[model samples]
Target: MVEINSLDENDVLFGVVASDRKNRWLGMHVDHDQTPPLPWWMSNPNQMPQWTNFLPGESNNHEYHGETRVQMRKPTGKWNDVPCDKKLKCICEININ
Candidate 1:
């Protein structure tokens, strides 16, 4: 996950990645369970608001990446999708059950 366990690491990484102006890959990916697709994290039974979070004009827009997958831009933390092929830094989260 982009969120780090250590505060110092978080600060350093946040500054470095945020200034780069590139997408940070999320560990979660799209699953076509419904319209606009859903990321793995959202699909979890406990997760709510699964069908929302698409910014204005963002859902399935295909403007930048035809094979759209989830991405999050730094600072603003806006959720969006980009091409699956584009290489970017990754954010990971561990789910305990």
Candidate 2:
């Protein structure tokens, strides 16, 4: 497993792609804590949230290119469908008092 200790705010999480025992491309996000911004296409045209930050490209292409995005929100559970070959980006945050 790849471990990133220091990540910037602009970094995008990467996921891997691999065939399971059934020979299926498991395309899923492994890290749920990092909630990448939803794409504009997926968002509502009439209503937009203040925190909307959709990436320029599509999630499928990101996976095809061997790259995944780390979401801002923390994950609640693990994704069993996530492939082994996908790569994810992470952001490291620190508070200064």
Candidate 2 regions with alpha-carbon error over 4 angstroms: 1-49, 55-85
lDDT of 1 by residue, 44-95 (tens): 4344333334446654637535544666667654556677787887765656
In TM-score terms, candidate 1 sits at: 0.51
Clashes of 1: 1
How many angstroms is residue 46 displaced in model 1 relative to the true structure, after the best TM-score fit? 10
Q: Per-residue lDDT for 1-97 in model 2, tens only? A: 2222223221333221121112212112333223552322112323323332233333333344433332332221112222345444322333459
Cα deviation in Å at residue 68, candidate 2?
11
Q: Output the lDDT of residue 81, model 1.
A: 67
- In order, candidate lDDTs are 0.54, 0.28
TM-score per model over all chains: 0.51, 0.21
Error of 2 at 34 (Å): 18
List ranges where model 1 is wrong by over 4 Å.
1-20, 42-53, 61-66, 94-97
Error of 1 at 69 (Å): 1.8
